[model samples]
Target: MIPGQRSRPEAEALPPLLRPRRRERPAGRRGGSALVVGLLVAALLLALGAVAYLWVVSDAWRVRAVEGEAQRAQLVSTSEQLQQRVDALQSDLAASDARVEQLAAEKARATDLREARDR
Candidate 1:
């Protein structure tokens, strides 16, 4: 009937060494463990997020590198083709110059023959 008395004294029936002991936890200690658990969860989530971000960024970089290589190869091929075209055009220009020189010499000879015939 007392305020602090238990209806059942089952623990008291046991020896003092065998009785269950209960010590009151401070308010701060009880909440401290929960705080630690919450911080650990947050840290876990942060780590996962970092891993996901790195994976995505790395994938993007790989894609960009592959695309860049392809573009470089295409540019190199185009440049080689242009160089071949330039070489061909240069040879044609040289041949045309040689023909012009030959035509000039023949004209000079024809003019000389005409002057001789008139004289």
Candidate 2:
């Protein structure tokens, strides 16, 4: 006979303490461990997805930063050009004003000389 295997007559012959009792359920667990493993895999996938998302976001930010810097440089260049043009216009206006004043003074002197000669 195999070890630990017994007919009912032999099992009944053994003292109660030495007898092996029947079990209503199996010893090992399958469902609980499988659920725990499934949860762990899901968590790992979620963490990896988050990392990938952050990497893409960071890349986009870098591109935007570079574009912003280029735009700022272009704006500064435009502002400088506009300021130079304004300064040139101001100088031209001053010269035109000076010429106008000289012509007005000459006209006044001519009128006084004509009136003196007539008197």
Candidate 3:
């Protein structure tokens, strides 16, 4: 009836697709929906945090395993080097023992020749 307003029949005459829709739920229900969404978001964040924690723990375990392998390798190399040194020392000792025995036998032969000459 007014200059700027359309009557109910004129408003209804528009197509259903162009009609303004009213919210069916009350204003109080909106808060409940928001709370549910917030809880869902929090649950998602918690799950993501758990995944990150597991990833970090797994990486730490892998690092430790690698470090352990490195240490084992170093120990094995050190043991081999030590064994080589021990073998070399044993060979040198054996050579020295042989030389000492040969000197002793030569000294005994010289003593026997001196005794025969004296007689």
Top lDDT prediction, candidate number:
1
Candidate 3 per-residue lDDT over residues 10-91, each given as its tens digit: 5587799877777699877998999999999999999999999999999999999999999999999999999999999999
Instruction: Return the top candidate by TM-score.
Output: 1
**Model 2 per-residue lDDT tens digits across residues 70-100:** 9999999999999999999999999999999
Expressed as tens digits, the lDDT of each residue in 1-119 for candidate 1 is 99998786699798999888898899999899899999999999999999999999999999999999999999999999999999999999999999999999899999999999999
Whole-model Cα lDDT per candidate?
A: 0.96, 0.92, 0.94
- Model 1 Cα shift for residue 66 (angstroms): 0.6
* Per-model TM-score on C-alpha atoms: 0.77, 0.70, 0.58
Write down the TM-score for model 2. 0.70
What's the number of clashes in each of the models? 0, 0, 0
**Better candidate by TM-score, 2 or 3:** 2
Stronger candidate by lDDT (1 vs 3): 1
Model 1 regions lying over 4 Å from their true place: 1-18, 22-24
lDDT of 1: 0.96
Decreasing TM-score order of the candidates: 1, 2, 3
In candidate 1, list every pair of residues with a backbone clash.
Answer: none
